[model samples]
Target: MVKQVRAARTRQALVRAAAEVFAADGYAMASLPSISRRAGVSAGALHFHFASKDFLAREVEDAAADLVQKMAGEARSSSGTVLESLVGTTCRLLVAMAADPVVRAGFRLGSDPSRKNGPGVLAWWRTWVHERVAEAREAGELADDVSPEGAAAAIAAATVGFEVLGGADRDWLCEERAAQFWAFVLPRLAAFPQQAMATVTGAGGVR
Candidate 1:
């Protein structure tokens, strides 16, 4: 039992270290030795926990997906209109991603050619967004013409674009920037009625 607990702790420490290394250096540039050093463990230990760099990267992606899904679930449960729920869910996701080194690294990894189309992570994100958009549409918060799949895709793409553009240069302002990004999206996505538009614009404090 003690051995199992120690192994679990060691594995977690390695994951946290890898997250930091990947966030700072990008997945392609990050090395096992560096991650081990950051975790205060030997390279052999890291290898023991994860057989390969790809395995470690996939673990990071899974961790990020779990975190994102939890946030999405919580947002869905909160009180709000469908558009509000969508925007709120997205905002929470961005905030979590901004705060988590693993999530940031996973996002970078998902976009990189070397790690593209690995499994589950990006697809899960797309599906989550699509589900939320559909829910919003059904609730009369979104226009009838709005394509739930397309809008979800757009939100996912825009969120990624902002993250890439902001990069490490503007890490401090990620949440603020994420809010601004969603503000731009809310108006276009809400039902086209003047009252709906007004509510959205007013809620976001947009002029």
Candidate 2:
């Protein structure tokens, strides 16, 4: 039991360390030795858990996707219009990414096309967004002209772009940018009725 716990801790530490390295240096420039050093683990120990950098990158991507899924679940459970839920979820995710080194690195690494390619983390997010948009449209919250697939692609692109921009420049105004995005998107999402707008403003105001 103790060995298992230690192994888990070690693996977690490695992932955390790798994420920081990747976030700072990007996937192409980050190295296993640097990650091992940051984690205070030997290269051999890191290899024991992750055979190669690609494996480590995949693990990071999985961890990020898990985080995104959790946030999406939370948003779905909260009370609000589909658009509000999406915006709230996006805010939560952005906040989490800002605080989590692993998540930041995962986003950075996953955004790079030169990295791993099996269905990728961003693709999963896009699919999730597409499904949510379709659900909202069916519920009569979205405009008749709204295309789920197109909206999903746009949202995904905007989100990734925001994150990349925020990460690159410390002085970038993240909250301002997010608010601008919401301002522009909310009206388009509320093409149906006042009730839909109320859903976003009432009890579940993207807390």
The prediction achieving the highest lDDT against the true structure is: 2
lDDT of prediction 2? 0.76
Count the clashes in each prediction.
0, 0
Residues 1-207 of candidate 2: C-alpha lDDT, one tens digit per residue? 999999999999999898889888888899999999999999999999999999998898889888888888887888466776777777666666778776677678777867856646677777888887888887777787777777888888887787787786742324445555666676776565455444444322344
Clashes of 1: 0
Give the alpha-carbon lDDT of every model.
0.72, 0.76
Scored against the true structure, residue 124 in model 2 reaches a CA lDDT of 78
Q: On a 0 to 1 TM-score scale, where does candidate 1 land against the true structure?
A: 0.85
Candidate 1 Cα outliers beyond 4 Å, as residue runs: 116-119, 171-173, 192-207
Evaluate candidate 1 by giving its C-alpha RMSD to the native, one decimal: 3.1
